[model samples]
Target: MDDPRSRILPLLRQGERLLWVGQPDPRVRFTGADALLVPFSILWGGFAAFWEFMVVTTAKEPFFMLWGIPFVLVGL
Candidate 1:
């Protein structure tokens, strides 16, 4: 694979220096807030998905189903 930084070098202006070049660590780091947020997020997402599913299956109007689509995608 080509160096990812190669593409960035030409974009630098004259006399400018590239001091740092690196990729972010591909690891999951959790904070104390995650203890509350994680479960809340799961419940919120589950409810959104369930709402969309019910709307799609039970609703006769297209508007109702369409309204919940964005919420479902955002939940994902």
Candidate 2:
């Protein structure tokens, strides 16, 4: 009754056997696509942030400034 597998015992079928209990490695590993994606993301995010800044600071139209908020968030 002290076994770790006891936690899941209720969910098993009448004759089922527990063979393995494990979790995947928690790690971050970048791949080849990241070489291209990293720079592109930086450019897109930078432009979006700049546009939002300009709209918020100098643009007088409320609707135009508000529209850029979503773009800035997505860029992040």
Candidate 3:
């Protein structure tokens, strides 16, 4: 440990001790999970936006009003 009057002091209150800091593994690698989730999220968002635009412009009847509910919920 260094002197107590160090230039940059840690903000610990009384009766505190530093345990651990920083990532256990700093290395980066592609994973199977990200490969699947990324594509799924993109497709979900695209479909939601397309459905919303169609409902707003081309079709605005009573049935279409209810139809857009699913897209809005998914987009949110």
The estimated TM-scores of all candidates read 0.58, 0.58, 0.47
Model 3 weakest 10-residue run by lDDT? 1-10
Clash pairs of candidate 2?
A: none
Show model 3 residue runs off by greater than 4 Å. 1-30, 62-66, 72-76
Candidate 3's error at 28, in angstroms? 5.5
CA lDDT scores, all candidates in order: 0.83, 0.83, 0.70
How many residue pairs collide in each prediction? 0, 0, 0
Model 3 residue 63 lDDT?
84
Q: Give lDDT: candidate 2, residue 52.
A: 79
Candidate 1 lDDT over 1-76, as tens digits, reads 7875887899999999788888767685887899998998888789989988888778867998888878777767
Two-way lDDT contest, 2 vs 3, winner: 2
Off by over 4 Å in 2: 1-28
Residues 1-76 of candidate 3 have per-residue lDDT tens digits of 6554452346777887666554456566657898987787778778877877887788777687677778667645
